[model samples]
Target: MTTAVAPPLLEDTQLGPKAGGFYRYQNIWTGLGFGIFLGFVAWLVSHATVQGSNWGTDMVVTCTMVAWVVGFNIGMGTFNAPIHWILGHDQTHEDELYAAGVGQGSSRYLKFCTDHKVVGTQYLVLVMVLFGVGGTLAMMIRTQLITPHSSFLDPQTYNAIVTIHGMVMIIATIIMVSGPFANFIMPIMIGAKDMAFPRLNAMSFWVVVSAVPCLLATFFLGGVNAGWTTYAPLSVQAPAAMDAFAMTIITFVVSVTVAGVNTIVTVVTMRAKGMTMGRLPIFTWGTVVGGALGLYAMPAFLAVMTMMITDRATGTSFFVPEVGGSQWLYENIFWIMGHPEVYVILLPPVAAVLEIASTFARKPVFGYKVAIAGFVAIAALSIMVWAHHMFTTGWAPNLAAPFMLTTELISIPTGIIFLCTIGTLWKGSIWTRLPMWFVYLFVWNFIIGGVTGIYLSDVPADQFFHGDMFVTAHFHYTLLGGAMIGATAAVCYWFPKVSGRMLNERVGKVAFWMIAIGIQVTYFGQFWEGFQGMARRIAYYNPHYETANQMSTAGAYLLMAGWLVFLYMMINGWRHGKIAPANPWHAKTLEWKVPTPVPLENFLVDPVVTSDPYTYGEGVPDGQEVPESAPAPEPELVPAGSAPGDQIDAGGAS
Candidate 1:
């Protein structure tokens, strides 16, 4: 197997001077920049609380804070400083460069780095930590739900646990799917060195991280019990915890906005020559569309969260029933962002699954153009379908007809993605590899998830299932099936690429089966329990619901076991598994073309484009095996007025 020659750094005369200036001022500016911004926000909040007449001031301060943060990162050279130092420039010191740890934790991580890979890993870690915390809350809720009318926990505590669980899970879903895989894999797939704006990438992650403490503070400060949605009069009536929740959500929206901008810029501008829109990988296309949705949807969420914060702290009656505040405004704004937010969390992972399936099946992604179109359709359709979630919440009946139509229309594009997956696997030499297994599972799970979604979207059917266990079951199917499964599959598929070691197949398979079965056991019961009239978030549910709840609890054990085993396998693999080849999966992607333990700047020389990634079967040159080595063919170099050093012909034809 041949190793890929790394790509050379592209010189940018226009950017070089600006980059140097920013690097020179980086250390001093980054610390003070964030500090000043935080101080300003604190002051504004304090002022608003005390004086009470300056409603416009809060909006102005928010805009200014966001702008300053974005500009400060750009001014400090967070993104390109590492690249500058690594490319043999001496404007920056070795110590400064080393402190940044190449591209892994650039000083940019303290600010913003435009490297999607770094942002992705940041999201992965962030989401995993939150997932653990969320799961703890879930355990508490489960413990309460285990027995009928038992006082193991008080009603208030139960409410807090349920609320926290829902909020954390929502945040986890948003951050998990797009952050790691999209950040890490998208550039690699499209053959770029880094995201279009590495600084913005870093900013996105830090924005998300900064929000976490605020979220946790909610629990300590009499947590909001209205669940993550924080609906209506109950939300306004909640304690100081509601303030914290609102602030946390606002922070999250900013993070999503930053991420959205970065993703859009990177996908639009950073693709390799010949990697046109039609040629872009399925996952990359998914991220592009998903990021767009996030960009458009997040601003509305930010507005609503700000309005909520005002309602809680400043007594501005956006949702206050008595003071010209319409509760329906909250519902309108929340679902506007909320529904598309679901697709934002989901589509990228679905895209990742498509890429995984194509890679392991040793085939071109079936209907590549069709898949891209599907993603675009899904993005557009996602916005119009938001009211479907609010059908029974007294939205206009006229609204329901349009929303119902749009919601159901989304299935058309969603089905296209499904068709692509099935076609990719049809009559193909499928490798029963760990990644592929997860891909197969994703398809099955997503199918069920999609079908279940139909029932929820139909207004008539949703009227019955609106606030019951059925809603929970539907979401679990959608999230676990579509998002979590796809994310896990991506982890398995790319773990070797990231860590340069092979995970244990046996343990991986064990984890996969347990998770698959466990999910079925856990959520399927919710459907039956919901059908029989069980409400969610009640500490003490009906005794008639006991059997299904017990079964779900039992399934949770299996689920936990599967995750534990998977974690152990990954940790052990990193420590002692066999060193991996550069292209372990024998896939056709630019990332696999690079050496293992990817270099500081990613490539040593710029790669010249040749062919599309998944050009399998007859598309590949006759009698030429898909090289289980590098994505690029060996280049014939024109001697630089001298013979090449120790050129060894590895007995292969060009």
Candidate 2:
């Protein structure tokens, strides 16, 4: 194996302003500038070739967008380390460049810093922006739906808003937990200093960042009128704005694929010496499984997009009916990846909730093995169930029965997840930390989501609910309730570790109840509208559904209010919240074992495991684990394979 050279210590001597050379390249504006220059150049070249028609402009726009992607990456210096590394060149200074200059202050957040924590923070900020925009788009949708007529936006404008909202939110959901928590916390949990490939880490983060513009670019380009799932024939006929969605997804998938490989390698190879597979923390397990799903699943979406792009730019009849193209081909590839995608969104939060549940419940996670089995089963069964999504299309009617069976069987594993969580809550003096409250909410909301999912798994019930608001509610329950709720829990739980500040508990609770209530109110109202036979993605609705639509819109605004409060809580808490010591919750995970504003190299040396990290209750012994409600022991550098660290590792013994 070619062992990657460890970069220099994360905290390096800062260069003075007088310093020249690579110091000039540390900012993101450089990337933006390069992107614009290249994009304009590409546009000119296209215009020079094509004349008179909009086709010339279309080609120019397409070429410019492609050039900008390259330029943005170039500006970020993403290509620097790779070219040097591949050619056996020295890049020792490249390490210092990422150390983020003299003060290493807030500017690091804007620059391409290689630190996992830095990259993770970047991803967090990115999602916050994306979600905020997506939320605003959603409120518009709800507003227009009120009173069953065109009001806030015209029908075409409404379609564009809906399409943009749907697509951005899907990307947001995919990255919400996985990008932030996994990037920041996983290596820490596995006892590694950084990800297996730090450069790849920065690239993964910035690539996603670079793609954001293209996603939003659809708004001005005649709009992406198709739903988030552009599908075939429809996507083929979509306006030029659809190209932006395709590029956004395609770029995001590349990021996912890159990050996936890096995460898997980190876990498999970088665990603290004795932290065996069985000893791995639940969140680490979640990261690995989620990463694996992304590694395998996202490429399929990329393939679908690539072909779709080709169909547009080259006049290839890939999806055109008259020229021997097949629409089913696109749907098959998309859903094949799509079904596993929910699990990809879901697993990290599931792992996170599982972790929080055990700590706050004052118990070891009940059925750790069963939860692991559940993860395994969910991943194994997820691929087979994609066709359950296709039942409504009637593309392959005969296959529906087998797909339905696999879909229902998935419930057995999911049921195990519920079993483990509920079992942990049983008979324990549950300490409801602000974060843990959301974990419990995740359980409740997910139950509704899951049971409804089972209902939809069957062909007959799906026939009833397929095209309506019921479908929307079901997924919102799962995706929002599962991923978003859990991400909030994780942020609350780990805020201290990330920001070195304690989150305001009362504030979190208020935001939580408001958002949770808003979610239930909004989706359940939509559910009733669905029962009244309301179809989604339309500007106008039937007069019979006015009350429910109005109610749903009101609830939607409420949800938006809650999110604003939540955003306020996060920002205010970070800037002025109380300073927290290392382990505020007294959790026993390896991350909590570290000190505040964690150093570049996570630990002085890697941690080794002697026993499971989640040892609850006394085994009639004095010092077996980091006890509940005990003040955290002060952290210090311990040598690898040495005394104090060994003792610390074994201290969590059962």
Candidate 3:
């Protein structure tokens, strides 16, 4: 058999500004202008061609959004490389460097730069914007619930706010950890220079950028009133805005699929010499698993969304019951992606927490292999348990038992992960840093979330809890409380490395307490209302439930205020916080070994992993594995000006 030859690696060259060509004219503003122009042209054509028909408006919107995606990519220089290839031309070394954003300074963040760190930073900003939009909608929702008969928003308006809010937050949380930390931190942790596919990394981010406008455009197009799930019958009946929502999901699936493949491939093939699978960091494992699960789950979302748009635009009967389509089919396909998505949002942050716990507690992670097993089991069982979400639908009564059993069984591995966290923190002298504080918050909040989830997982108990404020409170505990909390900790933990500055610990702590207390007050109020038999998704409620609703609303305002403060802290810290040195936390991970404001290739010399990263405490040799119960006297701090992996032949920047 003939052997395949690999392409030669490019020699390192100092990157400079663009060499004056077509790319100089391309950026996000250019992309926006092109997209808008194309969308308007498509709208004019579709309106001129079709009028006074059931699918007329939907066809216009769908065609317009498609045109926008294509036009935006064209204007962003996304098609330049491929077009060059088709004409027997290739990007020179300088073109590649320019695309990687070497000397462009701040403007690179707005362009289609391929640097993984730049993409990660872009995802961070995107997450904030999404949360800002979703949080505003949340405030509107809580405002409406403040009084029993409040007409703060009309029914259709309230439903639209809830629909967009659910979807925006879901998308934001799914990418919160994986988008930022997975891209910025994971490559360094694995000793890779960059992702296995860097151009795809940049494309993944810019594609999501194109999709966000489509989601926001939904409101102007009369809103998607079918909720975030966009369940059948209602979705099929929704106005043209539903077309925009479907386009957003379809576009987002491309981003997730591309990003997932890059993450998995980077970890699998691009890992540094000697960085064997067993020696890989916990966060690396967490990110890879999350990426893989997202790949497994997103296809269903893509399929359902495609079918949804077809039904709306082409007069198909895929989800239209009166036209012989089945609502049960929609629910099945939706939840097939839905339940695993919960883990996709959860795994990265949970793994980050484990990494943080090991660092701050001055100990090795307890049961490292077991934690990996827990992630695997959670992903494996998540797919089998999706039908539990349909217990109340009455579509398949017989499958409920099997679904319920799988749901509860999945909790076993979840408990194991929790136990590992506790075991790691048990006897070590814990450093109560800002990141560690969030870890404590995660433990407390996730316990409540897990226990309440069990109550809802039971078939008999779910009869009361499903579709009430109880389900809302339970999932908020899981997603917002658990996953979001973990993401916050990761931001705090890695902020110094990413930004070259220390976070404002004082203000961060204040925001942390307010948010923690607000979560308790808000969800606890909802929990009480659910127990009192109050239904969900209603603008009007009985007068008797006003007190609880008021409490929930008041607590929601607290959450909003806390997040505003957190946002301010982040911006101010990034702009004005004290300059940091390499390895401020003195952690052993390869990322910490790198400089603050890490360089273009990550390392001047490639990293060769000699041992596991979490070798803390005294008397433990550098490469020796620490067992779950292993302990020693409190480890001495690394002297100022030195870090754990400083001995490696690597370069650093101040």
TM-score of every candidate: 0.83, 0.92, 0.93
TM-score attained by model 3: 0.93
lDDT for each residue of candidate 3 in 378-424, tens digit (9 for 90 to 100): 99999899988899999889998999999999999999889889988
Candidate 3 achieves a global lDDT of 0.87
Tell me the spans in candidate 2 whose CA falls farther than 4 Å from its real position.
1-24, 52-58, 93-103, 620-654
Candidate 2 accuracy as lDDT: 0.81
Q: Give the range where candidate 1 is weakest over 10 consecutive residues by summed lDDT.
A: 645-654
Writing each residue's lDDT as its tens digit, candidate 1 over 459-572 gives 999889898898888888888767888988888888887778999999999999998988888788788888998987788888999998888877777777787788889888
Best by TM-score: 3
- Candidate 3 positional error at 174, Å: 0.7
Candidates in descending TM-score order: 3, 2, 1
Q: lDDT for each of the candidates?
A: 0.73, 0.81, 0.87
Q: For candidate 1, what's the RMSD?
A: 7.9
Clashes of 3: 0
- Index of the highest-lDDT prediction: 3
Candidate 3's C-alpha runs over 4 A off are: 1-21, 618-654
